[model samples]
Target: MLELLDLLWTFFKIGLFTFGGGYAMIPLITESVVAKGWLETSQLIDFIAISESTPGPFAINIATFVGFNQAGILGSIFATLGVVLPSFIIIVIVAKAFSKFATNKFVLGFLRGVKPVVVGIIFSVAVSFILQNVFSFSFKELGDFIFKWSTIIIFIVVFAMTRIWKKIHPIFIVLVSGIMGLIIYGLIL
Candidate 1:
């Protein structure tokens, strides 16, 4: 009961404050969930991957996943609703007022300024994820320890395959990566 309410309120606040969609919301979610001890950083990373692979908005997907992990189906419903409600209400209000502010210079200027800020926020989230998961900043000697070539090769191959093999579904790429990782791990161990 109280836990459900907490889930709803927390996700609602996240949705309300997060601008520019999922990537932009990552930092805020990390602070709220990971820093606050609601979830671990590894759990957040898994949520991110699952969210990206699922349908609908990435932010909503993530919110629902986290909520479901915490308190099952009902929690997922509440969290999803909380995450989407603000966007729905804001869109409705903006639509109703569009005529009045359609040609306002101030509005235009604000929109222009917002674009770069949103890009910056998304970029920062990407950097954080890379540092946390891919590169741990532990490379003391450049020659002694190089970047993980296997991961780099996988990335390049996947990128190339996606561009060239237009008919292949993204899920296939994910599955292949998983299999490759297992095989590599088995050989290494």
Candidate 2:
């Protein structure tokens, strides 16, 4: 159907243009999904959280969720296929020529240039997420920043935990955080 085709084309565009994967693709995915009226910003954020917490690649998880929400099982299939197809084809071609370009200065330079861009993209996404979840600004009154203290506290704790316990697995941190959320938001507040 036409709906399936549209889903395929839209996700195809998203997958083809995005680089660095997952977090880096957040802005693009958010914009496209919101513009298409598939999901609201808050819902997208929730979806992102769910996607990150679950298994598989973030981008693929998001595509599957969005597609399933829009149309159902077949929609999920089409959207997933559309998003993955470009990378599949590109990888196949690149693999064939990788040996030839492996020592090429141009390829090396291009990859080096991409590293900083990916970092910037991921940093921007992180900042946006912090702004949305942890800060509220009153721009009319000289841009006063109001903090969501609990979320800020949690962020600090998790950050410190990671830095302090480098050997600890992330799943443990996630589990602890969930328990903290339940205690803080459910029981305390």
Candidate 3:
């Protein structure tokens, strides 16, 4: 149907244009999906959190979540295909050519140039998420910014735990954070 193709094309463009990774692709994804009225910013945030926390590749999970939420199981298939196809094709082409051009100055320069852009995008996404969660900043408004005290408390505790315990694993931190969220937001506020 028209909707399925739209889903496929939207994510196809996203996957093709997305240079970095899931984090780097966040801004583009937000613009595309939110502009299309496919998902609200808050709902997209939830999908983002779910995608990050769950197992499997981040981009695929997010694409699938958006597709499923927008349509259904079939939509997930189309969207996932759209997102993966570009990379699959590009990697195949690059793998074939990269060896021959591995030492070429142009290729090397292009790769070098992309690294900083990717880092910047990821860094911006991190700061944006922190602002949204910790400072309650939203895309919809400029004023009425309020501090999220409970989230800030959780953030500080988790940050301190990470710094204090160098041996701690990331998965454990995520689990603890999730539990803390449940306790603070779900129960005691």
Candidate 4:
């Protein structure tokens, strides 16, 4: 009971404070979940992958996945609601007030200031994700080995394919990547 409440409150706080949506929320979610020891760092990375691949918003998907892992269906429901509630309420209020403040210079300045902060947060999140999943600095020799040309090539190819062939749904890419990884791993080891 208390655990559920804590989960709700944590997600609520995250949702309320994070702006610029899912990408911006990643750092906070990683910090809150990983630093607090609520979930393992590896699990959080898995959540990010799953969240990105699935339908719906990234943050919501993460909240649902974590909540379900921690508790059950009810936890998933509560966590999702907690995460979305702040955005919903804020949007409603902002929609009502936006017209009135449409020409306000101070408001415009505040928003402009926020954009860089949000970008910084998202960039930090991206760095963290890349470091954890793609790079390994713990063991010097192994870390050097991990940066293989094949893996780098795969990343470049996938990135280029996504940019150029925008019509390909992301799931297909994920599936193909998974198969490629499996085949490569099998051949290497």
- Weakest lDDT window of 10 consecutive positions for candidate 3: 138-147
The residue pairs in collision within model 4 are none
Q: List model 3 lDDT by residue over 79-118, tens digit each.
A: 8999999999988888878876788889889979988988
Residues 1-189 of candidate 4 have per-residue lDDT tens digits of 887887898899889878787778766776786677778867776666676687888878888887887789988887888898898987887888787676689978888999898988788766655554555533324455257665666667777888999999867788767766777677864
* lDDT values for all models: 0.75, 0.80, 0.84, 0.76
- Candidate 2 ranges with C-alpha deviation above 4 Å: 104-106, 137-144
**Cα deviation in Å at residue 91, candidate 2?**
1.5
TM-score of 3: 0.85
Total backbone collisions, model 2 = 0
Candidate order by decreasing lDDT:
3, 2, 4, 1
What ranges in model 3 sit over 4 Å off? 165-170
TM-score of each: 0.76, 0.85, 0.85, 0.82
Deviation of model 3 at 48, angstroms: 2.8
The candidate 4 region of ten consecutive residues with least summed lDDT is: 136-145
Number of the candidate with higher lDDT, 1 or 2: 2
Residue 81, candidate 3: C-alpha displacement in angstroms: 1.0
